[model samples]
Target chain A: MLKNVHFGPSVLPFLLVLPQIIVTLVFFIWPASQALYQSVLLEDAFGLKTEFVWFRNFEELLSDPLYWDSFKITIVFSFLVAFLSMSFALALAIFSDRVIKGSGAYRTLLIWPYAVAPVTAGALWVFMFNPTLGIVSYALSALGYEWNHQLNGGEAMALVVMASAWKQVAYNFLFFLAGLQSISKSLIEAAAIDGAGPMRRTIDIILPLLSPTTFFLLVINIVYAFFETFGVIHVVTAGGPAGATNILVYKVFSDGFVGLDLGGSAAQSVILMIIVISLTVVQFKYVEKRVAY
Target chain B: MIENRPLLTIFSHIMLILGVVVIAFPIWIMFVAASHPEIRMTQVPLPMLPGGQFFENLDIALNRGMSGMDGNGVGYMMLNSLAMAMMIAVGKIAISLLSAFAIVYFRFPFRMFFFWMIFVTLMLPVEVRILPTYEVVANLGMLDSYWGLSIPLIASATATFMFRQVFLTIPDEMLEAARIDGAGPMRFFWDILIPMSRTNIAALFVILFIYGWNQYLWPLLITSEPEMFTVVMGIKQMLEAAEQAPQWNVIMMTALLAMLPPVCVVIFMQSLFVKGLTETEK
Candidate 1:
């Protein structure tokens, strides 16, 4: 009777959300399943042309040098972009936390880049880095060093990473700043009164308290690296300088969409899902308990 | 609140000023470059100061080849972007709020399962399933349609998750009071829950608006008709069709124009933006 009583009211609410359930099922789950299924099959333009190939595609991907290169590139790029962006963001957040004036203006100006479309951001950055007419290129020349991303693999990857990171720093800073603001002033005052140095106060009080924000940012940054950077890379590098910057998503995009190899692309997508899920699980297992509320 | 620490304050200001410069310099550079003509754009020493042709470039940039080629015009693509952004934002927000309210305040069998289902969607980005998604929409006969672009995005798990979190923060007593006053679940949500969540809704609107505005890959894949291309697509079209080097001034101008909507939204909803970020932790 008690179970029925609770269930009665809940039924209406569930029905209220019927549209979302149907939509998600029809749109998200169905498509995802289709992709997963296709990963193991050989599909032609008309439809699935071959029977389930089981692990053949996976084996092929593993054996392929280009696949490994892309996989390695993805890992290195994610870490470099995530770590450097967060560090710069933390510095900016700490600085903004101290502002008593014009902080609003500073914040509005800084977050403007995040609002720019990724394609537009790519276009703008490429314009600035244009070897001949680019102000940035000229500046580098004046400083007695040539900067050409088109020719160098390492430089190309680094330039894409830096551009992607710059787009995200404002977003990370926003969250970190909010975390800083939420920490009680009294805690900082107490730490100061106890003769804690600025560094000591930060390490002891602020860092522990900011763990939740950091964890959230960490998850988000990983997701952004996996999903968002493809557009920028497509524009700036086109996975160029001999496909040196061909990260996983870009590879999937090029292979699946551009190259018209749907089955291979689907295989790559499955691999990507596994990587993202495992990485997410690993992160939470290691750090979830440490995140202080 | 710390007192008589002018030296510390000075040090902090120095750090802040430098931080601001690093953050804002690229945007300032883009704006400065947009102001210059094409020849000046490629000059050995690029102009550090804003130039006079800003409006002229903006004029040519907004009116040229229907796709913003030939150093002129970006109007049609901008409209496509604004329309698509509106459809995605409003549709996603409305459906998410309804779904979130249902899951939060309603009691039912399999409630936890339904909630988990939505939560799981947060992990499956559309990009991973782009090919299959295209198939589903294609089967629905939605290719290149507004419905195609908007519907796939409207059932967003992230927004539902956010709304659920925000609704969970509302005091249950208020909801109980509404129930006792003969209000139905929908009425209670409309009168009490909705009002309490206005600020949250505003912030989510801004975030989703920006997301829709920035869409590139989906728009490119879904639409082949040149008339249907969004601003980002138009920019790509322009980049490819440029003669020798991309007309930097025109490209920068178009980029700036594409950026204005979210910039305006963020400035107006600035308070809600911070509030939404802080409230997520709560």
Candidate 2:
């Protein structure tokens, strides 16, 4: 990607790149490789003895029902988050795009949640849904429904999902709005002229053109739910109600830091690395295809 | 104005208003909670409207801090967060600008290798390798320090890529003209390149500031000391403490304090934020 007629050869470039390279090596690459290495080695609880067990940690994880449960929970949680936030954002984006006036005001109102931290979002929702004094739960009780996330697994999952999804809506809305703005308006005009109603035009033309953005947002949202939502889960449920809300990332933290199962946690970390690497590859592939288009 | 569809427009406006209401509902509740006295918050059917204790609660949260936990006031934690966010945003922008400039302007050996190295950091998010990274940080004796909180998170691939893209779009004639005037590479960078990318840098700084401010888990992991706790992570401590005392008013006030800066940034610098977001994602 370098330009022609660039600067002559010198040691300046190496000096310039050194800080980033050092940080990457020490923080990112080293720890990642340590995870890989530790996944194959088992340490005793006292940190006194170590046994080199190649692949046993992974094998053990594969057979563990709890691990599988966390895996399943993560998938369900991420998809729910991605689906809920993306659909809501897409709806808002479509509406905002259609309106000719005050679109910027609508955008300003909608997008500030992107700046709200997930943990703060979690606190807000958790307060609103607290079983005893929360106004929302108080209303729910009036309607003959019990809303105790602390005791119910399903409620815990739902609470985390809502908190996580709420914070992400702004991001998805921004991208969807950008995508909508980028689409050719003449196509919508032509469709309207052909007697296609607004709904028909959106379904036939707008959604198809927005697929690339939709796909990109889907991946990004899944990634967000996967990793960035640790704070939400931590602050809201703490993976409680029988670990029903414990996703994979949380499990890695709990197992390693809390449970002291270093090998198992490292194994989980390695698996997560694989997942992220694959997701990044998919995003790049899609980006390349979009560029070609 | 493809069609004069009054009914559709009315419906669209209604739905948008509804969307805004739902999105803003929790925030409204948060504000209402923050405004009331502590005793009122614990009573049934929590006040749906604001009380006159808003500034009082802010004073308590900022000065006295939440009881039954580390007594670090909300004001102090906000300072920690501000410092961390500033360090991360500035550190990332600085390093990324240098690396991007080097890669774009110089034909150096192992340049592609370094680029890929930086790119790989994108995949290894701190969440995945939590224990090992913490171990490394602890081993380096960086725990509870600002450097520990900011340095690990500063190696950003997206920023580098964004700057690279920005530099590539600049015309080559500027560099040539500068060279003809006997300007050194660093001089050209200072006088021309950085000035040209000023808007991009500002936009990126807005996004990164939010990013650094909003960090939760890493700060929670490293900053064991009360003084080092960021407002975002400190909310967790207050939440945990609430399990015992239920200080809803003060905790809500802290949450508001934590969110205020970044929310203000996004709202005030809306266009720059949008630009940085879209460009970085690319």
Where does candidate 2 clash, by residue pair?
none
Predicted candidate 2 versus true structure: per-residue lDDT over A1-293, tens digit per residue: 99886999999999999999999999999999999999999999899999999999999999999999999999999999999999999999999988878888999999999999999999999999999999999999999999999999999999999999999999999999999999888999999989999899989999999999999999999999999999999999998889999999999999988999999999999999999999999999999988765
Name the 10 consecutive residues with the lowest summed lDDT in model 2 chain B: B65-74
- Per-candidate Cα RMSD to the true structure, in Å, reads 3.0, 0.8
- Candidate 2, lDDT over the whole model: 0.94
lDDT of 1 by residue, A69-174 (tens): 9988888888888998898888878767876776777688666667777787777777677777677877888999788888988878877887898888888988
- What's the i-RMS for candidate 2 in angstroms? 0.7
Quote the lDDT for A222 in model 1. Answer: 77
In candidate 1, stretches whose alpha carbon ends up further than 4 angstroms from where it belongs are A1-15, A44-48, A203-205, A279-293, B1-3, B66-72, B173-176, B243-245, B278-282
Candidate 1 collision pairs: A10-B107, A10-B108, A133-B42, B61-B73, B62-B73, B62-B74, B63-B73, B64-B72, B64-B73
Model 2 DockQ, alpha carbons vs. true complex: 0.89
Candidate 2 segments whose C-alpha is farther than 4 A from its true place: none
Instruction: Give the interface RMSD of each candidate.
Output: 3.6, 0.7
Model 1 C-alpha lDDT per residue in residues B34-89, reported as the tens digit of each score: 89887786666778789999988887777764233444367877888888999998
Could you estimate the TM-score for every candidate? 0.92, 0.99
Q: In terms of docking quality, how is candidate 2 classified?
A: high
- Model 2, chain A: how large is the TM-score? 0.99
